[model samples]
Target: MAMNDGMSGPGSNSLKGITFLLVDRNEALLRSFQETLASYGAAVYSVCDISKVKDVFKEVKVDVFLADMEATGQETSALIRSFRDSNPGGSFFLLIDRVTYKDALSLIGPEADDYFFKPLDPDRFAQTIETALGQSRPKSNSLAVIEPYVEQLKPYLIFRSPEMKQVLMNLPRIAASNQTVLISGETGTGKEIVARAIHVLSRRAEGNFVAVNCGAIPDSLMEGELFGHEKGAFTGAHKTHRGKFELADNGTLLLDEIGDMPLSLQVKLLRVLEEGVIYRLGGERPTAVNVRILAATRIDLIK
Candidate 1:
């Protein structure tokens, strides 16, 4: 049994219980659309800043991702493809101008569930969303799906070596808390699987588990990628964006290659750990977020 908690409003067209993540730089438009859907009881998470559409998933899981295709600078087809890669079971819809609707139709064919043009018709907008939610009907099994895998792996999980047995035995107990866990090992030693197993046994089992490789992302974009930034903060800034810390709120964030993180970013990360809040780049106010940090490193941190 997965935890699928949501309730619909009083009518047939209610998008009740369907979680929405809306992306658009136009604050008024985003708010209007959110109000329209939220009025029907959909749990909404929104970030109207950020260049790439796929970046929003850094710390959040959503049933439907609605975006402004062109202004966001993330092409319609590519956004659909990238988001679908991460969330194969997730639903996606793009908002395009009528002038480019034909191009959107041709490019995002079968990739996105649907699209709507600007100056949206309120009734049709709601209907299109309802239709998209309706298409993703099976609902996600999520971390609950990992249960069968746990049992299958259990039989072969035993360690004849004393050193390995003790480590395995303590794993379950460690997973039971909200503590920050450090997992270290040589390359390809099943460290990620161990982390997943821990997540499966933990209370956050129902929430999304996000993983990011510190060594993979570029240094210039790392701050914006992890802490997010406000629109107009930089030259190419398009909209408000949420970082990985925000994306992982109420869930797990696996920080792989923690050692590879730059010194300056490490300072900011330490602040997040110590204060439980993060200040987005170029933004004056700090945003509070709750994310369980699971760090992994190939090398020993101390000498």
Candidate 2:
């Protein structure tokens, strides 16, 4: 079916840039599932025939796989094994009714990432999918406790030094909180990577992760870059523009090399942080925003 034809639904655009492959014996159920995901800006390819799954996989790269356990029957395990062998990175979720739920219990193995009951609620399904995609790594208390959340950071960070470990030890706690963070480290120390890891681990992981280098852009343009501008706000402003804060609404924003920002810009940033709103250049009203800020610097302001 065609995906995302301007349909409105819960968590609008939350699944943007995501792809799904859905399989089921019932065409109605398949269509419903496709429409639900498509409404959230997902590219969905659904098929009622179990045999056509391989052909679909060959044609498209799928991030998440949803299959009806009743349709697969005894071959469920083999199908999951084959899919995982070929696409180890993809996530697999099973769909089953209450009647088959008990029987399907045995089929839930390492290959299946999760399962959803039939007659799925769209909001819950979307939320669950977002949560699963956000927490890409498998859950393991051993890594979070014994190893100090190192497993979750493996994809973004690689460190062996005790000092680095000590720095990372507080990562989980910091990520769980909603407060702003200041990541201080010398240049080339992977402060950006650490910021990315924090964003990935935070509650806003499903939202956009935006980063702006304060030192790279000219000071004259910094205000417009952060607070955006209305159409005709300036000689060059022909169209309305969204700033970094607007773009990162409901997500995390990393201000890299924050120490380089001019004092005037810092005051404006502090105002936005305190008020949770921004005034576009040449605009009269304020636009509220929900963003988590992560600032990185090579210089120590504290000292």
lDDT of 2 by residue, 1-303 (tens): 001123334558768878888888888877877778888788999888778888877887788888888888887888787777767688778887655655555555545765666676655566557544543443543233314335556898876777766556556556654567899989999999999888876657778899999999999899999999999999989999999999999789999999999999899888776567899998999998878899999999877
Candidate 2: the clashing residue pairs are none
Worst 10 residues of 1 by lDDT: 1-10
**Candidate 1 — which pairs collide?**
48-240, 49-239, 49-240, 50-239, 59-247, 59-248, 60-247
Which runs in model 1 stand beyond 4 Å of their true positions? 1-149, 152-165
Question: With candidate 2 superimposed using the best TM-score fit, by how many Å does residue 302's alpha carbon deviate from the native?
Answer: 2.9
Our tally of clashes for model 2 stands at 0
What's the lDDT for candidate 1?
0.68
Every candidate's CA RMSD:
18.1, 16.4
Output the TM-score of candidate 1. 0.48
195: Cα error in model 1, Å: 1.5
